[model samples]
Target chain A: MPAEHAGPDGPGTARGFVHHACLYGSDEEFLAMAVPFVHAGLAAGEPVLAATTPANIELLRAALGDDAHALDTAETAYFGRRPVERVSAFLRYHDRRARPGGRLRMIAEPVWSGRSARQTAEWKRMESGLNLLLAGLPLWMICPYDTRTVPPDVAEAACATHPARLDGERVTPCAAYRDPAHYTASVPPPDLPPPPSAALAPPTADLPAVRRFARARGAAAGLTGERLALAVLAVHEAADHLLTADGAHVTLSAWEEPGALVYDLWRPGPLGAPVPALAGYAPPGAARGGEDGLWLARRLSESLDVRSRDDGTRITLRVAGPGDAEAL
Target chain B: MAHTDGARHRGGTSGTGGTAGTVHVGDLRPGDHACALYASDEERASILRGFLLGGLDAKHKILYLAGADGPRGPGELLEQCRFTGPPEVPAGQLEVLGPAELSPRQGELDPAALLGSLRAAVDRSRSEGYRALRITGDLCTALCDGRDVSRLLRYEALLAAEFGSGEALAVCQCDTRRCDPAALDAFASAHPRSVEVDPLIRTAELVVVRTFDPPGLRIEGVVDTASHRHLRDALQSVASVRGDVRLEMSRVEFLDLAGLRLLMTFARARAARHCTVELAGVPPHLLHVITLIGWDRTPGLRLGAAHAC
Candidate 1:
């Protein structure tokens, strides 16, 4: 196992929002960096929450023995669920365990190699967005990446999202880390093929017909159960954004990718100003002021990519199906 | 078999029968499955008395399922309702039983068995030459006994499907004070018609008023993180049972993002079912806020004519 290294303040004295990335080439290397980080928190009496793969959790449990019982663990299966929900769950857990005037420690690996392309994109967005969401909170989070398992591009993206990286027992600042707001703002829309020519015409007076068209296409493409339901909601919320505006027109198309249901909505307008990172995390019932539809669409779908051009704004929403992992 | 309140009696009976028809306690028709939500013992007894008396006057066989609490027993309830005759128990016009008597097995609530028993009772009432079988019961005891609520809802749905338009009537009573809000909401949705004799009024924080007339829900008070779960459960219950829902939000003082999200989810689900959701009586400022969010243009959702903003 890796040994715990002393920060500037000495060993086990880190505070505030400390973001770290653990780059390891093997399970032993990952556990080496992870176990000591968790043990340091336990020694300092900070609440520790671990949200890693089930295999890693068992490894830590075996290493910690009875002490592992005290650590808060998240369901590993949840990483593949809606990114917003996972964020909400983490916030809730943090709120519950965080002591007044005390800091909380968390180890979260929200993205893995097997995740669908859409899931990976959403997880990356969530990683960047968390910088704003957890600002001013007394929390420290370390996201681990398995160099042997995670793709090179993903590992590179992690370096850009986290302020620091941990290699074995050595910790150093990541020169590549970009401010979350700037990084999120610069994320280009997903690259997808053009919609089939048979796409539904622009929605006008008949909004219900448009929703029905999307639903029929989604269902026929083998999107069933929760995936289908999520696709329908995402399409409706996005279409609603355009359908409600005067003279606004929207063209809808849906098709099945290898492991996802994709809907493309095109309207003849520029995507409005950049949506704030915190908008997605706003509590329900709080006055949204504006961006209500966009906020809702983002939260409902697995991934939402908006490409704005002088000619039009194209909104692409991807919902991961049961076969999402299989396609990877 | 004689009552002096001719006008009220006539009004009650006129609304009975048919899936689309409205039926209150005083106007219940056979084969109707009604849910009555009460906030107090007095309200519970009043609704029960009206329902039972209406059945007796119509010459139907009456069955009362009482909990241990009260109006203590059926005799007390009859006295409260001002029945002029000696106890009609020996005369066989009415029967009072405990909730367990209807259970197919001890300590368990089986929907299929319960339905079978109800069907048997209906048949027995017809063979005994009664006009119809009218049953009323307090579900608090069963729920307290750990009866599965989903099973109970399935039973209610089964009852509605089997006898909703026929000559037998069942009124399941739930005391709001004893039941959890989520359970109460579920019970309300399971039945075809629900009546709240005692309106649910809480300290100004939040109050969800479920109305049967026109079949809609009125939300008054703040819809924030503190109360969004309650709002979601309440709206979901109504949405699960009915296609067209009228939401009266004019009285709503404040609605946060969470509330708006719940509303949007509800509207989307209803739209998928091809149902219309009408938002009525929205204050102008709130209307402005809703329009700002572009929710007014959501599919299957309509802003009522009363919305000025």
Candidate 2:
């Protein structure tokens, strides 16, 4: 038996095999991490039950390819407001096909805030249903948000009666609750494309070509240069891996993992000759003293950025800033 | 037969009762001819004129008219009600003067008055050669200003049995909404025929199901355990004799304990024959109730969900 993740015991402190699952991290990461367990289980002649929303089910099915024994609970979506019955029905369907050595794995992606009070009752019912399903079966539960958003009763019940091994942290999980730094460090950053190869002559003032390139490749490809540039800076500041295409660039200052072009396209530079200051001042990650300097760089993707008095601090990357950001 | 001496010397104009001759009370049945009661002399005179000139039945020649304590011997009563011929062909001629009974005491309810009214109705039924008589509020009012259900049913049974079995059906109306709670309670209490619909489900034998936007039964909160037992007994009784008689549960909201017990009994009774008892319009709450009690698992009791309209 494993000392489960909770209380003072940290997530990394596990003696037994720890299964760490992430939701919507990336198609590649998900396939690399989650798919092997499913295939291995199925190949072993043990039934593997996987539940995702209707849209995600298709993606999963596409990924699963030939091993599609999955049945649709109405296109992989439960029909009504009652999550318990829907999950119960899904489990029932799975039970019919379950082999002797099979185990149940259920993943639910709630559209609402998992931490909100409004969904407490519904969550409790869902927990109860999950517990019911857990009877006579080994179940693994994954919810990709903070559990603190759930009502205290629901959290307590989940902690006490629920037999599931829960994943995902909306607020924070108990195992990582005491250590804020390790918890914060665990949040993986988004993958960005590498800079274009072979530096060419600076653009002319017209810059229409650069604009078109940015518009076509960067903006249209869902990466505006501004945000991408901001993210690149943030990634450099954090000293974490920046996965991209155009080959892996091991800068002295930053950690960069290449081959992200599969998902991102490069936007050409703006049509203007570089100014002296701009050309002279290199990025912190690509500067003279690189890796160690980047290592010394603070994590830019944090909740607080402002410094008191003379204290200098960096702000973490958030889609919204300050007053506009949604409450966690 | 025992009151012959008392009856003969009680009133004036006794020997000369009528020109058509007096009729003995013994000839009355549930369905006879017409028996009427007049509140005033003017009404009596007009009624007499209408009957005599308007063609009356010779059999229904006996008349009882009481106006301001005036003379009303059988002879004058006969003149007041001269027979012409039979009323129009196939006309329902049986009538009863249920409200004509007089008593010296005011506001005192007399059960005998109702009996007498029923007796008059029976006499009128006999005169008309009809075996069926309709008794409405007039007969009910004559029975001391309130419904006398037992006496009414007893009279009905007497009239029906004499003429032929199942010849009479008394249509008793009980509007719970308009009726006083005490009156309704009293009526419901005394009358075995009165049914109070199960509120959870709007099914009942004799209880009136009210129509609302969301239709359901408004039950009288009190549970009639005896009635339930009676219903069960009735169901069980029929189960053995007629296996084909379907126990209809159309208006029932929810089965009470007794109803459930009876249903189980019936199911067991018919289990040998493999006959099924069907239940319809069972509400979800009621179904839950039954399920909680484990009654739903009983064999031979098949119930279908109500169709949503």
Q: Who wins the lDDT comparison?
A: 1
> What ranges in model 2 sit over 4 Å off?
A1-24, A32-49, A70-80, A87-116, A132-328, B1-247, B254-277, B281-309
CA lDDT for candidate 2: 0.34
Per-residue lDDT of candidate 2, residues A147-201 (tens digit):
4343344444443323333332221333322122222122212323223642222
- C-alpha-based local distance difference test score of model 1: 0.65
Per-candidate TM-scores read 0.51, 0.31
Q: Give the candidate number with the greatest DockQ.
A: 1
Model 1 per-residue lDDT tens digits across residues B1-309:
011111122212212122223344665777677777766555565576668767778899887765554444556668755545533443677776655666635756566876787788888889999988898777544653343477768777787887765778888887667776667667776766764332233333566656553456776655644567888778865776555888877556545444766787787778999998878876554454456345677778878855432
Candidate 1 off by > 4 Å: A1-16, A26-32, A75-82, A116-118, A168-170, A185-189, A205-210, A216-230, A241-249, A256-260, A275-296, A320-328, B1-20, B23-309
Identify the leading candidate in terms of TM-score.
Answer: 1
